[model samples]
Each structure stands twice: as C-alpha cells, then as structure tokens.
Target chain A: AEGEESMAAPADKRPISTIVIIIAMQAEALPLVSKFRLSELPDSVFPKGVPWVRYYGIYKDMNINIIWPGKDTVLGVDSVGTISASLAKGACIGDVFLASDVAFHDRRIPIPVFDLYGVGLRQAFSAPNLSKELNLKVGKLSTGDSLDMCPQDEASLTANDATLKDMEGAAVAYVADLLNVPTIFVKAVTDIVDGEKPTAEEFLQNLAAVTAALDQAVTQVVDFIAGKCLSDL
Target chain B: AEGEESMAAPADKRPISTIVIIIAMQAEALPLVSKFRLSELPDSVFPKGVPWVRYYGIYKDMNINIIWPGKDTVLGVDSVGTISASLAKGACIGDVFLASDVAFHDRRIPIPVFDLYGVGLRQAFSAPNLSKELNLKVGKLSTGDSLDMCPQDEASLTANDATLKDMEGAAVAYVADLLNVPTIFVKAVTDIVDGEKPTAEEFLQNLAAVTAALDQAVTQVVDFIAGKCLSDL
Candidate 1:
C-alpha cells in the first residue's frame, strides 16, 4: 500500500492550494472569519463592479476567502462572474470551492448535499466524493428565491423530484461550475417548509439559533479543508 | 490566559463517557452509524418496552448511541424516557446529549438553533451554552406533531414571535431536561413553513434530502464530542 501510494502519478495528483468559501449570510461568514482568523480585504481590493462583499485571509497555510452573496441566488448572479474571475487568479495552483447556504426542507430534518442544478444549467457541479470525507449527505438540491414558490406540498415535492431545496445552492453551484472551480456545497437546515406554519414568525424567532448552527457547519467544513490539505501535502 | 489555563480545576473536570444522539429519520441515522462505525444493539438488549431501535457503539473511544425517534415529537415521547434512562445507567460518568432534527424559518436562509415550545410541554428546554462550542445557534424552539396544526401565515409568525419552529425539538429537550441530562440540541432548517406550498406533497418529495442534512449535523456533533473528549485525555 505504501508503494502504491508513492507510485501514484503526479499529474493525477491535485493538492488543494486555495479554498474559496462562498456563503450567503454575514452571520455565517463572521464565525468562520474569526475562527480561521480571516481579515476582510479592502473594498478596493475586490474586482470592480463586484456586487457582494468578499473577505480574504489564510488559515493554516491555505488561502481562504469568504464571499457573501447577500440573501439569495439572484443577488449572487450579478457578481458570480466577478467572483469567478478573481478565483481564476489562483487557477495556476489547484483551487477548490466550498459553497455554504441555507435551504427549506419539508421534513423536520436537515440534509446537507451538493446541489445538482441552477436555472440555465443542467448537470450542475457538486463534490459528492468529498461529501463523505466531510460526513455530509449528497443529494439533488433545488434552488429558487421564494419559499412561496418552493414546493411546500407533497404534490409539489413529488412533481419537482428534488430531494434538497434551497434559495441559493444551485446558483452557487452553477456559477462555480462555469468558472471551473471544483465546488462542494455545504448547507444546514433551519426550517421545515411544509406550509404547516407561518415562516416569518418562525424565522424571526429562530434566526439567531439557526444562524448559529450554520456557523458551526461552515467551521467544520473549513477545518475539514485544512486537515485535508495538510494531509495531501 | 496561561495562568487561567493552569488554574482550571482538574477535579471538576469530567471526561465524556457516553454521547446520546436523538434523531428522527433513518436517512440521518444511516450516515452517522456508518461514519462512526456504530452497530445495532439487539432489540432484547434494550430495556423492555423500548419503542424505537437504538444503535450503540464506540466512536473515538466514546460510547455513542444513535436513537431513531421516528418522524415527529409525538413519536419521540414514546422512547425519550427509555433512551434517557439507558444513558442514565452510565450516569455516574459524565454524558453529553446531541439532538438533531429539522426546523422552519421564514427567510430563505437556514438558521441553526434549538427551538423552545411544542405541543405538550408548556415550558421547553434548550442548550444555548453548548451552542458556541458546537457552532450551533441557541434560541427558543417550538415543537409540535402535526404539520397542519402549525401556523401557516404571516399573521401566525407575527403571533408566534419565534425565529425557529419544529416538530420535535422541544419534546426531546423536555425529556432530556427531565432526565437531568446535559443536552445540546442541534437543528438545521428544512422549510420556511410560512405558508408557501401545501406541505403533504412537499414533505414526501424532500424527506430524504432533509434527513440527510440532519444526519450530517449529527455527525459533526459526534465528531466534536470525540475531539473534545480526546483533547481532555
């Protein structure tokens, strides 16, 4: 096994050099920034016309940047290209992506997975192989903006056939794919979208707690990436 | 900080001996069981009248058990006491609890936290202190059994004033609190539950994916406990 390990080809070898974490919330980004000791880059540092806030710093010798897509995927598309081009700067070295966001699930459980599609693109990108390493569940994630538009009824879910549904996962996945960033999506569940209750109230009441959980999930991914990169070295 | 670290009382320190994870789905359970290499205990090994199947094994030298509480809080009440007592058998040693399930939020983003109230318990329980270490959000959790019975309009959210809502979190918390066990409730958002789509159809479609996310969150908790315990050693 040691001989086989050493015999592996270098061309087939991809050591993670930089990891770009694209997330949706400032809350989610704050904890990771602090945990990994990330510092916000100057606004002028970002590419011109970039619509979202971008933060950059290093964690354990790996370059890490967190991008906030502000609220939903529609907001993300405006800056996806800018985000992609910026990441392309590190293309000379292998770069991987870990996109984090929230989703609405009908079940009273949160399933984390790489989303499968965005609006225009079919067969969107995902890192299923990596999901296992991170102990995450991989499934088809549906992306849209409004919960009212999201399938809240069993009939809707059956019609959609998407196991995972979110407002932004697919858009991030789609944009990352176009940029050729090997991306893995990390999402934590916050609410059960089964039309049984009013969302505004639930969200307002549980926002702090759910955001906290999302923060934790993001931290785990960051740590996993750090550990994975170090071992690859 | 060095002096503070040194002054930390070793006598008051208790290493985690067992970790109990209560969840609602088989999809969530399968992943954790496999990742941690947990094995099922014989049905007969469980205390008589146990309503749910329990898996017990070791993950990083910690006795980790995964309990399936079926779909909602109503189902959980059946086995919560039994599960609590089982863990109490190892009560002389310190034990920690990680409760994983799904929730509802109004906004698209998923917030992670423990909800506060539910169907039966007038007062609910949650572990907010553990939220930071676990990277989870702590807040009021609302638990109930029927999705239809849940509030489904903006009026409801305004009326409830809760940020997080769920079907089972409070029940589990109430039971854990009653058992006098120190527990941390970890939940991911699944749906907005704010009257978008009818839930029956939606739940059937997205059940698998939501549960998987819950499973991943649970896995993180287990790993956290293991790492925390190992560092203590």
Candidate 2:
C-alpha cells in the first residue's frame, strides 16, 4: 500500500451492496458455492445453450452471486456484461496474493501507441486496509489464455512487473474499471510459473488444496468487506 | 452463406434501433464520424483520464454511436462492455471482406477443454442478404494483438481456417455473440498477412486508402441495415 495514492478510485465509493465472485473452473467454484449455501437457479440467466451457471445467496447483508463459466467456455468479455485469482510468480503454493494491478503478458502490439495499449495495463481497486488486516501479498497480476509461458511472454511479464499470472484477472479488472465498480482480487497460488514442475502437472496436483485455501481467504475478505464502504477498505 | 443454417440466431430479432461502431484507431474512426456527421460529446462518458472518445448522431432513423479508443489504448475487453474489417488473406488492397466467423490466433491454452476455450472460436452473425447485396467476400477473421505474425500464430490461424487477420475483430465478435446482439463484420483489406511486403510498411502505406474504402462500405451497409430487423439481414 506504499503507493496507494496512485491507485484509481472506484467510480462509486458507496457502502458495499453486492459481491460477485466469478470463477472460471468448476472445481474452484463448487466448494465456495457449498460454503455460502448458494442456490443454483433452475434456469440459466445467460443466453440459450451457453453452459454458464449462476448461484446466488445473501451473505452478511450483501447479495452474493457466484458465476461459473462452465467447462466448455473460457471467460468471455460478455460475462462481465452480466457480472479472480490463484496464481503467482516466485511464490510457494498456497500463498495468497492480492492484485494491486493487472495486465496482459501475451499481447504484443508493437506499434508506437498500440504497444502500450496492447499490454492493457490496469490498476486493481485499492484495498489497503483489507490487505493489512489479512497480511496479503499485493502485486501486479498478468493474464493470458495460455497456461505456460514462452520467452516472449516472459519478456512481457517482466516488463509488466508482474507478481502473479492468471487467465482472467486483468479482464475482470478491465470491466470492473469500466463500470466504475471497485474490484479486488484474492488469489492462492497453486503452482509457480517459473518452478521446476510442468505447469499442468503441478496445477492438477495442487488445485484442490489451493482452491480450499482460496475459498477460506476469499470468505475472510468478504466478511471484512460486508458492510464497509470501498473507501474505508 | 453456404452454411447459414448452422448460424446461431439472435436472442432478439427485433428491428435495429441503434448502431454502435467501435474503432480502435483515430485514423479509422474519423471518416465515419464525419460521414455520419456525429457530434463529439463535450463531456467524457468514460472514467476520468481514460482517453476514449465518443461521437453520436441519427442516420435514417437509427441512432449511431462511434467510439474511438484513441491512440494510447488498445481495445480492452471493457470497450465491448460499453461495443471489424479491413484486413484479409489472399485479398488485394481495398477489397472489403465480411466476417463469417472470428477467433484468436495468439492464445495457446494447452489444457483439455480449456484449449478449445482458448481458441475462442465464435461465429459472426449471419448476413447472407447483406453480403449478397453488397457483393462482399465473407470469410473467417482471426484476431491477435501483434501487427506481425509469428510461426505459432500462423499455426493457430491455420487451425482457425482464418481468411482475415485483425487486432480487434474477434474480441468484438465474442462480446456481440455473448450478448446475442447479432453482430456482423465488414472489413476493407489494407494488407495481406502472408504477402511479400512487411506488414507495418504495407499497413502504413495503405491505411488511408483502405479506411476510406471501409467508410464507404460501412456507410452503404448502414443504409442497408437502417430500419430493418436483424432477421432481415
């Protein structure tokens, strides 16, 4: 929170009314759904044939909505039209990281102005008090569709000064920023990007345990956020 | 239009009331802004410090909004939270192409099920009558941030069976598909991805001419779409 002053403020700083948790993988979603005792709507709120699932319940005076994009679909930009975290760099598995900012590491638009644009660097809504209370690691999160990083991706990651990498964080940040919604990312590391094990193998081996940790951390974060205004956080 | 039967129907087939044209570059946007006689908004509709520009007007009973992301920003997923054309394969300069489908040429999520999601293959809304009336070529459009293609990108593009390459088309198509907004892409070729000339040089050389062609084609398409239902297209 050293540079909290530079972080963009939410368009609206009113007291928290709703908290939406967006999960791409079903494994990461189910545990939280059960913990919150959310009800799966009998009918999908999405367009017909899209496999996205929604679960909602009231938690501590806030309407909590959890969305799972299902197995077949990746998180599309539109999911935000309706509606992060758990990965890191140089971190041990199960270590929780909160996004101070987010960006894209895979895109490389080399044109003069576009090179900056292609990186899609965005600031996550500041949550300094919550970070201090939870003792969280706060740093930049980089996103791309790919699971493993290549040399070019590595260069971009370094350029982005990324502390965590994931598939969906920046996208969520982008939309949240656009809508002026205050956003915070709580991520539990499952596998280190530059670690010894192959990403896929290590991810599968650690996913369940890490997801539980993420669920716990997110619940704590939510509990702290329930009635407080974003500015207070 | 050969495989039109498989195209997904719009969630709503009502008459078009508003048309949104999202242009990433100012050069590509200005002509259409003039053609439509759109007035630039005096106040920023977006969050402060973001350079996104908006122009609006009414043409032939349809409300038209043109958005330019400005020079410094790439089209973020959020831009769609607010809204295709002109690059092709085997296409001569100034040749207009309509997107039959769109996909990403750069993302490589290697995991099962996720890989399919990574490719993000999405079909553009079918426009058989519009294509027939305009005499425009229709083919799969591929999007990536890079101005130039690498070997891996080429492989992905081939896997996508892409006939056009662009920076922003697939993102736009993805959002439109998710919203069931009935999207169609009309592009004028500035440079061919596989051509002998270096992409940057060719793109810079041809941009003005191609954009003018794009403006004319888009004007005609708008005229054709004015006061018509999505189903009519």
Candidate 3:
C-alpha cells in the first residue's frame, strides 16, 4: 500500500532530491511510517535478515538498522562500536537525532531529551564529513516502544505536545544528537499517549499514509544532503 | 606458548572426560573454556575443538557444551544482544559483557554490573539440589578502553575496582549471575591497568603461565558443577 503511494508521488512532490540517511531500528521505523498511512514500502527498502520489522513502506529510502541499544546495552553499544569503526574509516555523519521515542523505567523519568540531542549534535558534527561544519537541528520526535502502541499513557502526551510516537527514533536521535549532528524528528499522533481505549492496529491504519508522505519529504531533504560537496557539504 | 605450558601438567592431569556440540559461531564457545586464567588452575583440563582431535577420549565423561547460538539472533536474541534471551532458554549463559568492545561510539558509557552469585544462592536455597543459587555481586568492571592502564591514577582504579580489567568476564557474569549462576572470569590481561612500558606481546608471554594455570582451575570447577552428583557405582 505504501509502495503504491510512494510510486504515485509526482516528481515535484517526491522528495527524493534530499534523502537523509534514515538510520533507524525496530519500533522507530514502524510508527514513523504507519502514521503516514503508508501500508507498505518497496521490498528494496529493507535488506533481508533484519532483527525487527513490524512497519512498512516508510523506511523505503532510509538505511534502517536493526540493533537497539537502549534495552540491551551490549548490543546497543556493539552497534555504536561498528559506527565508530565507520567513523574511523571516514563516514559522513548526520547533524541531529530527531528523537521521538521516550520511555523510562517509570515512564516518569525527567526527559533530558533536549540535553540528549544537544550532546548528540556535538558528536555527530565531528563525524567524517567533507565539510568540518554542518548545520544541525534537534526537534521533538514522538514514538512508542512496541508495535501495538497500546502502552502509552494519555497524561504523558497531554503534558508534552508531541505529535507522534515510536520506540526506536529516540535512540537513533540520542546517539546521533550527541555526535553534534543536526536532526529533525517529523512526528505523527497515531495514538493518544494515554487513553482508556488504545487500538494499535487501528492506530497504525489511521496514520500510515501521512507517515509515507512525511518520509517522502524527509528523503528529498536527505538527497539534497547527499549531493552536497564535502568541502561545502 | 600458552598451550605448551600445559605440557608441565602431570600426565594424569588431562581429563578422560570430553563433550562436544556443533556450533555455528566461535565467539559463544570461547566463553566456556577459554575464559579462565591458567595460573589459577591445575593441568589436563581444556576445551578441544574438532577436525583432527580425539573426540571420544576420557572426556566422554565430561559434561561440555560445544554450543552455537545458531546464526546471529535467529531466535529472539543475537549472541551480542544481552542476557534476556539467554535467560529465557535457561541455558548456560556465558560472556555477559561487563565492558563493551569498541565497535561503536556508545561503548564509553559507564553502567552498573550486578553479580549473579547472590541470586544463584537464592535459587539454590529455593530449589535445593534441583539447582543451587549463586551470589550476585554488583561492581564496576573495565576493559582495555585505552592502550595502557593508569595504575598511577588512584581515582580511576578506585572507581573501577571490581571492573574486569579485561572485557569478556562481565558479560558472562552479567548473564550467568542474573540467573543466580556461578561464573568465573579468566582474562588474558595483555594490558595492565598500570602505565606499563611492556609491549602487548611481551606481557602476554610473562603472564602465559598465569593464564594457563587459571584456565586449568576453571575447567576442574566446571567439571565439579556438572558432575555434582555422587558416583553411581
């Protein structure tokens, strides 16, 4: 379904010209795309053998990673270790985390999210880019941990004016943001953060198309990024 | 050279016991036997891999696991993920990393490590004989995050004391310990925490005997645990 939507996008409407490397994992990928109401993405979007894959077509152009560091520190850092190696070998880095997922053990831990983005941006800027300096942005991203999106509390949402939610985007943003990279988390409110009635499947169907559209827009921006000259990049 | 040190062991030291299982990866296997320090152990105990080696030797009596996690997280967990899946299967969890390998940038953060012995002890008391509980000790562990150790830096050492000066122990302990299992760490300390002038290769040679002895001791302990029962005859 998402594939059809993306395919139908007019060249002007298609944001392929600026495709940012959407490095995402697990739950983060699902909510982002599901909110766009994108039913499915191109098969080419994901390589075979990913750790988690609950969502569809929105990740079509992003480099979706499967490792989640938050729950399993070792695997999480293992992903980072590989990234570090990539950095050593001269990998270009993004400028922000654009994190949207935030859940605490208590779900009440003060959100140092802004601080997390601040640090990530600092480190990402140093990523092996042709240009030593890149403009970075950190924005509020909405996300939940599970595909069902049934656990989010409404009071939390009402407190923070977030637009969408997923599990993985926040971690992605946290890591990248600390690297001092610019990040923008385009979010969609698929489910009430806290609600008496939560329907994950229904929420997914409701927001899928909008997410695909957002992904399309984000991809164009990233494409613009990839085409920039390193010195002036 | 380390293997050769086993030569000095009394001829009878080599166990008549052996057990082997097919594995898909080497990292998981390395944890069971290779993890010990030779200096602390006696002779004859060792992990034997196959192709040309004697298989049905005295080790037929050995309760060994030639394990393979079977192709990277094929089941709910990758060997590199963390303790969750290992815990779920109720398998012998080895190498629950205390410190992470510098494969990613997120490796630098300090985290708490809880020992399993305490919990193991609790298990033993509850299941008395079915499975004994082990202690869970929480302490700091460190790996060679740097090329050399700063032994002179009292503060750092104090801060990271229980920290495994090497990497693999804590991971093993983390997983095993969490489930109230007894675990041992035999690290080949190529780099001391102290600022040493010794080259890495040179240091390993000096500690070769120690490593060998430690390795031997650990093997015996493993045998003891596996054969906790009295002689049948």
- What would the per-residue lDDT of candidate 2 be over residues B85-136, giving only the tens digit for each residue? 3354566888888889889877776656556666788888888999999999
**What TM-score goes with each of the models?**
0.37, 0.77, 0.34
Worst 10 residues of 1 chain B by lDDT: B81-90
**How would you encode candidate 3's per-residue C-alpha lDDT over B1-233 as one tens digit per residue?**
01122545442344423333222223323444344211112222332211111112223255354433322211222222111111111112132211221111112222122111111111111212222222222223432212222332223334333333432233344444333333333222322333234433333343434334333433544554453422210
Candidates in descending DockQ order:
2, 3, 1
| lDDT digits (tens) for residues A1-233 of candidate 1 | 01123344442253455777776556556777788787776663443333457678877777888877433222222211111100111121112233333222332221121111102223443444455665554444545433433324333334344544455565555344434455565555444444344654544455566566656666766666564532342
Best-to-worst order by TM-score is 2, 1, 3
- In angstroms, the error of model 3 at B29 is 9.3
For this target, which candidate reaches the highest TM-score against the unseen true structure? 2
lDDT, candidate 2, at A66: 91
> Which predicted model would earn the best lDDT?
2
On a 0 to 100 scale, what is the lDDT of residue A198 in model 1? 60
Candidate 3 chain A weakest lDDT stretch, 10 residues: A81-90
lDDT of 2 at B72: 39
| CAPRI verdict (incorrect, acceptable, medium, high) for model 3 | incorrect
**DockQ numbers for every candidate?**
0.03, 0.29, 0.04
Better of 1 and 3 by TM-score: 1
